[model samples]
Target chain A: MNNTLKKNDMKTAYIMLLPIVGLLTVFVVIPLLYAIFVSFYQWSFYQDSIFVGFSNYLLVLKDQAFYKAMWTGIKFALIVIPIQFVAAFLFAHLIKNLTAKVGGFVKTSIYIPHVISGVVASIVFMFIYNYNGGLANYIVSLFGSEPIPFLADVKYALGSISLPAIWLGFGFTTLIILAGINDIPDSYYEAAEIDGANTFHKMIFITLPLLKNVFLYVIVVGLTGAIQQFDLAYVMTNGGPLNSTMTPNLFIYTHFKNDPYMGYTISAALLLFVIIGVISALMFRLINSKQVED
Target chain B: MKKPKFLAFMLTVLFIISSILTGCSGTGPAGTEEEKPDDSSDSGKTVLNFWTPQWGDADKEWWEKNIEAYNKSQDKVEVKLEIVPGDAWDQKVVAAQAAGTSPDITTMNYNKIIFSAEQGKILPLDEYTDPAIWDDLYENIAEFVTLDGKHYAYPMLAEPSAVLFYRKDMFKEAGLDPEKAPVTWDELIEYGKKLKKGNVFGLAAAGNAAEYGWTHWGFQAMVGQQPISEDWSEATIVNEPTKELITFWNEMYQSGILPKQPLGGYTDIKPLAEGQVAMQINGSWAIGQLRNDYPDLLDNIGVAVVPTNDGNQDKPTASLGGWTLTIDGNSKHPKESAEFIQWLLAGDEQIMVDFFKDVTKFSKFTARKSVDEVLAQDSEGANDPWRKLIAEEVVPYAVAEPIYAWEVSMAYATALERVMLEGTDLEKSLQTAEKEINDYIKNNNYAGTNPKK
Candidate 1:
């Protein structure tokens, strides 16, 4: 009778899982497999596709544009991730110490950007960065300096574009980190304080060590988000000014539209996926190992 | 009691699931019926999906009104207009095509006509379209959508190539002829120098290669010639004319005659209107924008054809930028779609007038020569100086950018960016563009403008 009940429970669990499993199979698994399959062929939706047997991969590996885009993506992530980490941690800690009503106001204000669409945020930033009669140039004029081409100059375009991403990201990251901080038991901080720990010492000894998992989550997620950046580059610079702001995703998207480059586009996408996967794995391992050592 | 309660709960869950499963409330492509009110054909009207690149709210309302009119005009067909956002339209259409769910009729850029046709994405409308209608369309504009003596798409509006719009007041102040715009490239530079003063630029030449008008139309004026071979098989980026074009742009930048930042998109005429720029080159769309937003500046604005390098004032130099309505080859209702296209673009003169004058407020020019005549006779356009100038000087000279693989123009845009932004040598940049374009053409085996067998 117990075995029959166990079987029945198993059946119910499987039934419960069916809808999500089916959705994943249809949306994720099928598309991924199809992309992998298409990567091996010279495909254009308009024209007949031919089996090219990994030539697309070979082409992507050799293409200079591919490397340039990948490096830009990597540089973007490197700049964004650390900024997000420090800002989120500091803001969350400060907010956690505030009075409840004030904290709520601060949290909501900080979280507002998270809800703004990337395209909308980028457009707002575009006005700020405009070369002719932009807010940035107006400020520079006050200092008696010539106007800086924020979107036009290759040197400054990437950073100018990054501002929007950072604005949108830090808020969300802070909220997550804040939640993680709140989940930590008050007893640990109390004990640290009793042991003659000051606020900074209590944060360092009690809060930081305990928020390891959250840190891992934020950093890994932030890195991936930065790497897949598209909307900002699409709206603002359009991977222009000598392709300084071209991310891998932008490269993939541009090529994807060109039709004849379908094979190359898919191959590049898969390669980016693999690269992201490897980097994320390394990050996870490093973070987990650090936690163990602590 | 617990068993009974559990049984009741399960029965309720089953009832809800059954209702969801067996209910015919929501059916047939989740968004099809709702997002489009007149989508399904249950009312005995054949529904045709029409997709357009999204425009301003005003344009959207105008389109909906027209679609409704078309629907009500006859019970035989219901044309549903879906306005897709401009930046995302191409991707959305291509994805829909791949998924076998493309709209019956769609709007495409004039440059995309040849490539899309070659891809079999658009149907050749020669059979469905009336010859007289094609004849009525502006001849120069017609050249864009027609390939090998066959028209692939219906030309909707003609945004004539770059016209040198200058502040008449600024010109008068600078002792330059406000009546005659620059007659040559050198004259424009000279004029720019005269106009440049403290906190004001002579010209709003975009230094950064961003918009099509910034590079393509500017090159068209500078080269005073076509940069592509007649066959469209080779890019002439390394040719003398192209080099001269690049040199002119670089010199403009070096002289500080142009704005420090790239003027960006075609609609970027704010500098000119704000009096920061004395001269700017843009499409006729600016005529309406300035009239609406800056009525004070409207009287001061002077529109003239972009001058050529050789001082050939009469040479056809305007680069035509516009949209075309093409019937999707995958469409099941080709007849109905063609009828709708005809009604909107060709059949009704009143509708055409409404689109160009009433709706867009003369923001866009009609592609139809017949409609141009009607507009000229009408009060709204009769005394309009910009209208008269565009109809006579601009529309006649407008040339379509070489409609090769979409990548060719993009490669040119990139080359222009390198030359303008990075201060790269013109020769090297053009050579890079040439090599990249040739490689793309050969590698893709695109039959770009080859003689028909």
Candidate 2:
């Protein structure tokens, strides 16, 4: 009787898993496989596709725009990752230092930006970065600096776009990191205090080492998000000011519009996926190994 | 425990049943009326799907009103209107086409009309549409909707063609003739210099990557002759006329008459309307927007043709851009679709006039000459004689962006931007653009105006 009940439970479990498995197979797994398959073909809308046998990949590899766009992505990641990590870590530390009620209020306040829609966030940032009467310029003028066309100038456009990414994403990062910081046992800091360590020393020697796993999680997730950044660029600039803000994702989108070289776009996308995947896996492994060593 | 398990099972079954019932109930009312084959008379009405980009609030309300009017006008056919938002419209249409579930008729960009027609996604209206209907469209505007001498779509409203809008107050402040617009490139620069005050710029053209930017509306004015070879097989940007065009615009920028910052995007005439710039080159649609949104500035604003280079004074400098209503080739109900298009765009003069005056608030420039005539006679239009002037004068001179590829146009735009913004060598940048465009044409095997032997 117990065996039969166990069998029924297993059957129910499988049935519950069925919807999720089916969804993955349809939306994620199938589309990914198709993208990989199309990467090998010379495809266009309503036109006969030819088996190009990795020619599209070769072309994407050789394309100057592809390299420039990837470099832009990398540059954007570099700007976003360090700044976001530091800011989030600092804010999380500050929140952890506060009383529960005050901490909760401050956390919610910081997270308000994260809850705002990406498009709305981008528009808000656009106004802030506007040359004519933007908040950024208005503040800059108060400091006796000349007005800057943040989005229009190529020198500043990429950096201008990055501001919103940091603003929108740092709140969530802070929340996660704050939770991690809180999870650190009070005894570790208590031990450090008893050992004659100062507050800074505790933060460096005790708090920092304990937060490795959290940092690893933040960096990997943040790195991936930054690499795949699309919405902010699309809504804010449309990869303009002469494509200075054109990340690989925007480049892929532009290719899709052209239609004739869709295979080329798919190839570029696959290449970006592989590049990001390899980097992320290596980072994850390296972080895991460090944790193991500790 | 047994009782709890039994209750859960009962709840699960009830949930499933309720869900199915709710699903049925959701569509039940409409299904009975519309999906019912039992009512043969109702089934006889051919429902044709029509999709258009949701322009905005005013346009959406107008579209819904007109759609209802069209539906009530005929019992034999029912037009179901879907106002897809602009950003999502392209993706939706593409997906629909791929799935063979596209609307019977849809509005398309002028560039996409040729590309879609080439792909056989859009139907050739020449077969179903009257030849006279095509003949009545503004000739230059009609050329844009035609691919390989075949009409793929009907030309819709063109926006404010790249006409120079000047602030008469700003002109007066500069001690210049408030009524006179800059007639030539030199005169424009001269006026721009005088117009510049502490915060106000003398002139502003499209400086960004948007539709009004240097490459599009700006480049049209610069194309002294056409920018492509007569065959569309070659880039004419490498030539002397094109060289002179880029050089002049660059000089204007260098002269400090133009703004340091790029204009925000399309519909960014704020600088001109706010008196930050004395002159701005924008589309004819700005008149209506000015009248509605900036009524205070309407009296201060005057419209004129975008100043051309001395050699091309007779040639209109504005680029014609607008939507085109095309029938899906795969549509099951083609005749009904064509009939609806004919009624709204071509045949029904009253409806077309309402579409402009009431629906679009005279913001959208009409493609049909007859509708143009009627709207020009209407109260709103009669007060603004520039409507007729733009219809008769500016539109004829406006050329459509070359239909070869988007990249080709971007190449020209990039060259101008590099020279103007980044201070790249104008000649070298254009030479590179020419090579790139010609290569794209060759690689893609594009058929534009094929050169005559």
| Candidate topping lDDT | 1
Structural similarity to truth (TM-score) of each candidate: 0.85, 0.87
lDDT for each candidate structure: 0.77, 0.75
lDDT comparing candidate 1 with the true structure: 0.77
Fnat per candidate, as a fraction, reads: 0.40, 0.26
Give lDDT for model 2. Answer: 0.75
Error of 2 at B384 (Å): 3.4
lDDT of candidate 2 over B226-325, digit per residue (tens): 5556667788777777777778878877776876665455455777887778888776667766766787777888888787787354675767778878
Model 2 TM-score (B-chain only): 0.82
